[model samples]
Target: MADDSKSGGDLEKDQRSQEDAPPSSIYLISYPKIVFLYPTFLVAVVVAIFMSIAGESAQIGGNREHMAEVMSLIFLGVFGLNLTVLAFDFPRTTSLTLFFLGAALFMGAWMLLRFNPDIVPTITGLLKGLRPWANSQMYWLFASILGLIFIGVAISVRFDYWEVKGNELLHHHGFLSDLERFAAPNLKIDKEISDIFEYLLLRSGRLVLHPRNQPRAIVLDNVPFISRKEKQITRMLGALQVQVRPDNH
Candidate 1:
């Protein structure tokens, strides 16, 4: 009788413990949030393209034009140097790279002009583009498009985000608070080095989850501090598994 009573008491304790187990933490993960850079990059591309065109053809009034290959060379050099940026991972802002690149270009130009005085006329002509020119409103068009994209991305970022609960993965998106949930148990996580350049910039990477029941995987791109987040998810889920398991007794 005593044994039976003791067993009953133990059973009650276990039930209460299981019932009172706190919910596993909900982990919120978000993108690196560098969407504003899109406009900056677009502006750079436009400037580079225009610089090349300016070098190829000097424009005056509506119809006056002449060849100017010096501008083209500088444009090519700038574009080529920028491409090397892709070869290494860069940080969140490109200020350092841009600074270094500008310094290098300045030195190169100084050296060229110092050694070859004859090239001053060509360089002077290229410098002329910096002054006001006809058809200058084209720059305003680029600026407007850049502003629209900057505003659109800034607004969308607030609504679009990902989260991980012990049992499910959740995507909160759209202005309407639309939520999509996916089973997370037995969920396989993968971290991919999507772009070395991006990784170098912000230590960002693509994090993907394969749900046991879902045929397609959900992918989250440009997750900053990916390594830390991965460890956190693994630890959180492990604790959740322990909490949910039935007592062997």
Candidate 2:
């Protein structure tokens, strides 16, 4: 009986040790909020506004020939708006924004130079003439548009949020009372070092589980600061002793 009791106690100790053992692996998953360089957006906005004012002035000056240039300036203003949004890391929408902005700038600049030689010299001089007020309208437009762009960019940054703990993924977006939740299950991560845009843009990528039985994949793009997040998620998954697999879909 004593021998049996000793054996029982040893079994209990073994069980406790097994329970206390450190986890084998962990996977941490997170998506960092996109941050924009305010100065770049500011510069774009300033240029856009200058163009808009120049266009508007041409329209008012009864230079019917300058109407095309006026329209081009308006297109540039729209492009500036789209660029500001892209700077905030809206990858899914960036291509669309770029397309429209490029089209408008191209057409507008072409028409302005083609239609009105006299105004072209004046506007060109304003841009290149070195006079403080040469492109004064353009400068004012640029400053105003930049101010609006910053406001929108600030709102995007302030409202976006993301974090992960254990098996749960959390996201908060939009203004107050408009929140969203996403559960990242079977979380799979892939890390690569490649030029998104010659290092001007760096992209960290992620693939998350759909949490449904159906064979599907949820992809997260342009995630910045990925390594730290990878370590954290790995640790958490290890602690939970959950199996993670590559989601190829």
Candidate 3:
């Protein structure tokens, strides 16, 4: 069966060629996906700066308590926006229950205020008791630390991160260049978008890579465009498997 022998030889040749071929794609994992925290931190810095400037005004001394109250409200509102799915998403029944509860409270408050105008002064007094102010040193410190952490993360990502190639996964780390490799083909991958606010910020989430025979899985968080990465890895691994599958001779 010369024909059969020739086909077998050709298949072996193709396998050799495919093995020698360069990787179809390479992925470098980095840490800039934590972009959402920047906006709020930057806003906090601005608020701190505003307080310092306004502190110099003659009217500011007299109204320091008022500024403190306003600052607290602003911080509360902005920070509340960061609650992600914890706030926006709820079970259908749960949402309806909360809606009804809120409606009832609003109606009760409306009726009370309508009949008892004296409550307005009491509510104002309660609000005026809250004084929250960030001193200049505190805001500057907050902004500085955040800036430093971001910079350090950037540099660390540039040098110490993970890489995916056509055949293997690479973990690049350390100043002295410690490196490890794991089989990428047949790698199990899981992607998670646990936080909706995070998804809205950068289309990012967590990617878990389960390499064969490895006791522990690798989880990379704040990965940007994670869905795209997962698809690319799937296609790459699928192609790799097809190319390497055993054929009956």
Candidate 4:
């Protein structure tokens, strides 16, 4: 009797523990492509800090001036590259590779011309005019504005997001906490990494969810850490299926 009672107590404790455990679910939040500009934002912040330090130092003539010019050039290059990426979609890795190759060839040609100034005196004069120059204060102002914009983006996303649970898919939206639920029993999910560059930036991709009885799939784009979320949803649904499967007679 005592052994049976102890076993019963152990079973009760196991059930209670299971009840207390957090749900195994994934929250899917889609972000805008501007979020990927974080690389440029980070670079700006770093440049601001470096320039501030350089400005404070006693040695502020030849080397300091050169370093500031280099920093400004780097900042402009990154900003231009970021804008170029935003303007176009590199859907395939081949396209991305081609872009890099083209950029490299252009840079190589420019460098060759720069070194052999006699060949194209006009080229050196044009390059001198193209040099981007900015002070430490300018860098700080740019970083501050970008940082605030990022914060706004973060806050705006909270109003609309999706949650995937063991037995259902949920869309939670609106300022008033509106939620729409769909059955997950026969849910179909497709993961598409459409843009190679975007994926490289944030491991982001599109998730197409085909919920049971729905005529159209719910397409969510710019989802960060997409692979992990897909695996998690798969595991949750697989486990749910196993739990509900009928035994052979």
Each candidate structure's TM-score, on Cα atoms with residue i matched to residue i, is: 0.50, 0.37, 0.62, 0.84
Error of 4 at 201 (Å): 1.0
Task: Find the number of clashing residue pairs for candidate 2.
Answer: 14
Q: After superposition, how far is residue 63 of candidate 2 from its true place, in Å?
A: 32
Give the CA lDDT, 0 to 100, for residue 47 in model 4. Answer: 90
Residue by residue across 117-227, what tens digits does model 1's lDDT show? Answer: 578878856755543332324444545665677677657677988788768788888889999988776778888865555565566687888877888887887777787
Give me candidate 2's TM-score against the actual structure.
0.37
Candidates by TM-score, descending order: 4, 3, 1, 2
lDDT (Cα, tens digit) per residue for candidate 2, span 1-249? 999999999999999978764444333333332233344444545555555555534444653444435444554565565455555433443555775788899889868866765676877666443322224455456556766765765566556655565456555566773654445455555554232331244335443435434355545544555555556666665655445554577
As a whole number from 0 to 100, the lDDT of residue 236 in candidate 2 is 60
| lDDT tens per residue, model 4, 5-122 | 9999999999997875445878999998888888899999999899888762323465344666778889988998888778887878587688889989999988888688778778
lDDT for each of the candidates? 0.64, 0.52, 0.72, 0.85
Q: Which is better, 2 or 4, measured by lDDT?
A: 4
* Model 2 global lDDT (CA atoms, 0 to 1): 0.52
Candidate 3 clashing pairs, residues 3+ apart or interchain: none
RMSD of each: 12.8, 14.5, 10.0, 5.3
